[model samples]
Target: MSEGGIPTIDIEDFPAQMGKLREACEKWGCFRLVNHKIPLTLMSWIEMGVECREIIKVYAKAVHGVGMEIAGKLAESLGIISSSGESEEIFRDWACQFRINKYNFTPETVGLSGVQMHTDSGFLTILQDDENNGGLEVMDNSTGEFLSVEPLPGSLVVNLGDMAAVWSNGRVSNVKHRVQCKKGEVRASIASFVLGPKERVEAPTQLVDSEHPRYMRL
Candidate 1:
């Protein structure tokens, strides 16, 4: 874990860092990722024109690949799938939703809440937050208090959502988070959500036993 309560995972350290990634999902429900697949140039292009649907399409495809890879790692870390490459099938066909948000803050909005605290309904979300402004906050699972998430340059934020908890059978954390207005400036972010499976979603047999039963079916 890092000093800020969120863990940092480097994509370059994959398979080897599966333990770290699993810990982040179960403990923090979120983490800061470095050395991800998305290029900084692509991020800049997306930010330059949020209304450009063509650019968004390309970005979504790239992000979807990363999301699936992360999902496979999660499965491997949980012991649900072995290293024989079967983990990739766990969420190979899951859907993705791309979103770009721009917040134009004014004098009246300073020190106010930008987005209310809530948990995402999808399986997971990959976020590229603004590098300049700081307003994101996540609830600390240990202390039950919201902590500010400072901007980390060249890093992406990953948040596990409600469906993650459902799929993990209560093993993973589905945390609450929100955006605030710390300064009267514009803020923009790109979010890619990997929703639950296309078919029904249920906890794997390995995770549902006597001690750890299935929590819900969706």
Candidate 2:
């Protein structure tokens, strides 16, 4: 695992690595992934004009739903807390959501000539970028510097969010990132988030040990 607990693995072995993954989640709250088998061809097909717009849209919606559910479960399992101090509102915005933003390689649209930096507003984010294209950059909280993240073919990038850190009692951290368009190639990325529950107190679960938990609901 890297500084942020990012783990890369073959898609086929994901199930076998669940134990390690759970440990990573408990400790670092984020992971980088490789060989997830998302298929470069499919990714390419989606980027080749508007032919796959409908498919992409549907997939995005599904991703959002899944993210929300996952957030709720994470909250329930981790004993998430709400910013407003109301446990009933745990399923509200502080939990989970998805954001999909795409931009052509142009100076005007992205506001920074070709790149834009920002942090997501969810507990965890799952990102899929254009195959063979490079643009993602993440900030290293420890060093207070930005690091260029190379795009890996058929891989997904995952990051923990602010709410997650709060819910986990500062154990996790939300990463800052930016996207730069490659010369002559448009950039496209899909981001799905899993957030903690709203209205719940932001704290780690006592039932589960602070260092190693026996069970993680999400």
**Model 2 lDDT per residue over 1-218, tens place:** 12432445333453465455444455444556655444455544445445667766666665554444434434443444422133335545544555555666654444343556665655778777666656676776556665666776666777766666555665455566777655555677777776555555445455346465533232
| lDDT (10s digit) by residue, model 1, range 1-218 | 11354789998896788889888999889998889868877777635775677877887888888888788888889998886268666777887798888999887899899999999999999998998888899998988888888988778899999999999999999989999998898898889999988888889999999999789988
List per-prediction Cα lDDT, in the order shown.
0.86, 0.56
Show how many residue pairs clash in every candidate, following the order shown: 0, 10
Q: Please report the candidate that would top lDDT against the real structure.
A: 1
Candidate 2 has its poorest 10 consecutive residues by lDDT at 79-88
TM-score of each: 0.93, 0.61
Tell me the spans in candidate 2 whose CA falls farther than 4 Å from its real position.
1-6, 9-29, 35-45, 48-54, 61-96, 107-116, 198-201, 207-218
- The global Cα lDDT (0 to 1) of model 2 is 0.56
Error of 1 at 59 (Å): 1.6
TM-score of 2: 0.61
